[model samples]
Target: MTPRQRRVAIVLGIVAALAAATALVIDALRSNMVFYYSPSQVAAQQAPGGRAFRVGGLVAPGSVRRDGLQVRFVVTDTVQMLPVRYEGLLPDLFREGKGVVAQGRLAADGVFVAQEVLAKHDENYMPPEAADALQRAGKEQP
Candidate 1:
C-alpha cells in the first residue's frame, strides 16, 4: 500500500476507536445519571417509582421517628411530603425542621431508601434548590 494509504488507514482506525469510546461513555451516563427532586415533585409523580434520585427538603416537623439505628423522617416542601428511611447514625445537624438531602431510590412502598443522608452544612445555608422550593411554597427567609 502507498504511504498515503497507510496514513489514511491509521486515521480511520483512530476515528473508529474514538467513536467506540464515546458510545461507551454515553451509555454509562444514561445508566448512572440521577436527578434531584423535592417532596412536592415526588408527590406530583414527577419522580418515577424505582428510579434513583436525591430528594432535598426540610425534615418535616413532628415527622421524625426512630427505631434503634434506623431512622425515618418525612421530608417536606410545605406543599408535599415524602418519607425517608436510613439505617445509620444521624448527623448532629440533622433535626426536624432542618434541611436535608437524601440520595436513594424510591420504592413502590412509598418510602425513599437513602443510601446516603446529607445534613445541612450550616444553619443558614440550604441547598439553593431546596430554598427555592420552600420559598415558592411561601416559607422563605427563616
Candidate 2:
C-alpha cells in the first residue's frame, strides 16, 4: 500500500482498539455496579431479584436477633421494613434504631443476605441515601 494508505490503516486500527477498550470498560463497570435502595423500595419489589445491591435505613428497634455468628435484623424506613441476615462481625456503631447500609443480595425467601454491613460513624452523620429514605418515609433522622 502507499504511504498515505498505510498511515490511514494504522490510524483506523488504533481507533478500533480504543473503541474496543472503551466498550470493555463500560461493560465491566455495568456488571459490577451496585445500586442503593431503601427499605420502602425493597418492599415495593423495586430491587433486583438475584443481583447484589445496597439497602440503607434504620435498624428496627428490638428487631435484632443473634445466633452465633449469624445475625438477623429488620431495616425500616418508617414506611416499610426489610429483613436482613448477616453472618459476620458487625460494626461497633451498629445498634438498634440507628442508620445502617448493608450490601447483599435478596434470597428466594425474601430475606436480604448481607455480605457487608456499615453503620453510622458518628452521632450526627448519616449516609445521604439513608437520610433521604428516612425523610421520604416521613421520619426525621434520629
Best by TM-score: 2
Work out the TM-score per prediction: 0.88, 0.94
lDDT comparing candidate 1 with the true structure: 0.89
* Predictions in order: lDDT: 0.89, 0.96
| Sequence-dependent TM-score of model 2 | 0.94
Clashes per prediction? 0, 0
lDDT of 2 by residue, 46-131 (tens): 99998899999999999999999999999999999999999999999999999999999999999999999999999999999999
Which ranges of candidate 1 are over 4 A from the true structure? Answer: 1-4
Worst 10 residues of 1 by lDDT: 133-142
